[model samples]
Target: MTTRRLTLRQPVMDDAERIALYLNNFAVAGNLARVPYPYHLADARAWLRTWRPDKPAGETGFAIDLGGEGFIGQVGYHLDARGETVIGYWLAQPFWNRGIMSEAVAAAINWYFRVTAAPKIRSGVFHFNKASLAIQNKLGFIETGAGNLLCLARGEQVRHIDTELERSVWAERQDA
Candidate 1:
């Protein structure tokens, strides 16, 4: 999927280097639930090697590509046990605050809803990450509740603000 400033493409083995570069930073990894503080090329390679774009189930990963800037980040979604699609995304620190994440998210969510029959997309932002929270709100995700999750970056359980965007609401917004 192409956003105004980004192209959301499938992750490839060669993207491991760029992925490791950006995700290695504590600042970028801290807000995420799974990525460890010291992200490595080996980890990136392992992840890319296992990615299945043709899979009938599970999360689909996208490498966020900036036209000339190369790979900058990732955004994707997977269905939880309850059948709700869970959205996840992150961007490199140098690219932060440029509205890149917001645009990538909008495009990903738009494509997700179009291809899947899921009713809503669920997301949780670590409480301290105000930027992510702001993006979620700006994209029309309303808080459903709060919970705690183990953050590998922080190596502890942190409070997370949960939110969801129903397909009906997104469709209405698109129509307007």
Candidate 2:
């Protein structure tokens, strides 16, 4: 999906190197659950290989290109065994506070609801990552009182879980 400020497209092999750099930043890595501190190219290549876009229940990653800046971040949604679609994303530190992520996520969420009949998209943000929480709120995702523990890049334990956004609520927000 494409937006005025960003384009959300599938990850290409060439994106691995850039993604590895984005993943390696300690500031960016600290907010995510699985990204390693010193994320390597090999790790990025392995991740690219594991991606299966054709699977009925799978996670699809997208490169968030801010026109001239190449890929500033990545976002995606995956179907869990329980049939819930979980959304996740990470942006480069330099791109933070620019409203880029909000636009990318809004586009992704709209596309997901359009392509599939899923009623809602779920997201969990690490507690310390207030920026993520703000983004979710900006997207009209209400906290459903859910929370869980997640391991960070530094092997530090963090509580990183929350909220669900039903289609009805999303529609209402869009209408407003």
Model 2 alpha-carbon drift over 4 Å, by segment: 56-58
Worst 10 residues of 1 by lDDT: 52-61
lDDT of 1 by residue, 1-176 (tens): 78777888899998999999999999999999988878999989988888877954237868899999989999987776676668999999999989999999998888888887878889989999999999999988999999898999899999999999999999998999
> Candidate 2, overall lDDT?
0.83
> lDDT at 44 for candidate 2?
88
Tens-digit per-residue lDDT, 1-176, candidate 2: 78999888888778898889889888998888778778999988988887665744226768899988898889987765576778989999999998999999999888877777777888878888898999999898888764565556868767766778899999998899
Kindly provide the TM-score of model 2 when superposed on the true structure, using C-alpha atoms. Answer: 0.92
How much lDDT does each candidate structure score? 0.88, 0.83
Name the runs in model 1 displaced over 4 angstroms.
81-83
Clashing pairs in 1: none
All candidates: CA RMSD in angstroms? 1.3, 1.7
Model 1 TM-score, all chains together: 0.95
Candidate 2: worst 10 consecutive residues by lDDT?
A: 50-59
